[model samples]
Target: MSFQGEQYPGVKAPAAETDGFRLNHTMLRIKDPQAALDFYSRVFGMQVLRRLDFEEMQFSLYFLAKLEAGDEVPEDKARRSVWTFSQKGLLELTHNWGTEDQADFAYHDGNAEPQGFGHICFSVPDLDAAEAWFDANEVEFIKRSDQGKMPDVVFVKDVDGYWIEVVEAARMADKGD
Candidate 1:
């Protein structure tokens, strides 16, 4: 028998209150920080919230977060160590000089699964519009020829060779119920 579905025959579910942990952000290693910043901004509508520079180490890191409706914090406030307000989820971008040799440019492929870790997914208001934007912007996406029946999904790569997934918000809302 395949260990796909029966791997945990008697696995017990967690408590109702302990459903799952909140997703922080996927950290990516990129060669060119500026290029990665431009890609995310143009394709995914993500904005750079804060930037931390390590001048001595010849490396810099940027924190990016999707600008959701009613989610706007002044840049000065975010630059500080901590703010009185809550922090929105952000994607951490790491750029290290001479560290690009360790970066992976190809899509991740694990085991017999055709799809690898894939990419960090975000639920958007409309998939069609987003897809169009990606196409117009010349973003490359992997074809899901045999991934079975799945919802509308598009893939884009960041400057550091990481894939990002985009999903529809309407479908996500239905799944909540």
Candidate 2:
């Protein structure tokens, strides 16, 4: 069945939320800094928020995310040709130039799945619209099964092959009122 939050539509939309403390970002280990930066910037439109270079370590980290107008992106961020806005969810890229033995892993590749680790999910107002957008953009969903009475939910991989779950929230809107 669909999930219907009591205040979904009838009431004024849920008040904008402030998560007590500001969330900093998410860090990812990438092989090629330039390639990874290009992929996220070109495909997702995420701006580079910041960068930290460790000369001794020979590694560079790039922080990219959505940005709002007038947001001040540090000068270092410009070095990567990426920018960030005042938005949530920042993607941090860790690039090590001298390290060659590091093991590579995807978000879903490890067993024990570990606590504090899970798939990122997006709630869509309309599943049909989402599916259409995915089709138009040539995005593929990995596991999409919704034939039964339960609500429709699908899992898809991001550009980096990270699993993301997309759930349909609008179906519940038709149940009442």
Q: Give each model a TM-score.
A: 0.67, 0.54
Model 2: lDDT of residue 84: 45
By summed lDDT, which 10 consecutive residues of candidate 2 come out lowest? 104-113
What tens digits encode model 1's per-residue C-alpha lDDT throughout 1-177? 344342366876556796545555666766777678889887778887777789998888787877768854665754443431235467877887666454554323321257556567777787777777777988877532124355455556555556666777665554432
- Candidate 2 lDDT by residue in tens digits, 1-177: 375356644665335474344555667676666656766675446676677898997899887765658866556645434334343577777877743344563333222346455565656666767666666666657766364444477666555555556677765556445
The prediction achieving the highest lDDT against the true structure is 1
Model 2 CA deviation exceeding 4 Å by range: 1-20, 69-88, 98-116, 122-140, 145-152, 167-177
| Candidate 2 displacement at residue 120 in angstroms | 2.9
Per-residue lDDT value at 175 in model 2:
42
lDDT of the candidates, in the order given:
0.65, 0.61
Provide backbone clash counts, one per model.
0, 8
Error of 2 at 77 (Å): 6.5
lDDT of 1 at 104: 50
Task: Write down the worst ten-residue block by lDDT for model 1.
Answer: 103-112
Best by TM-score: 1
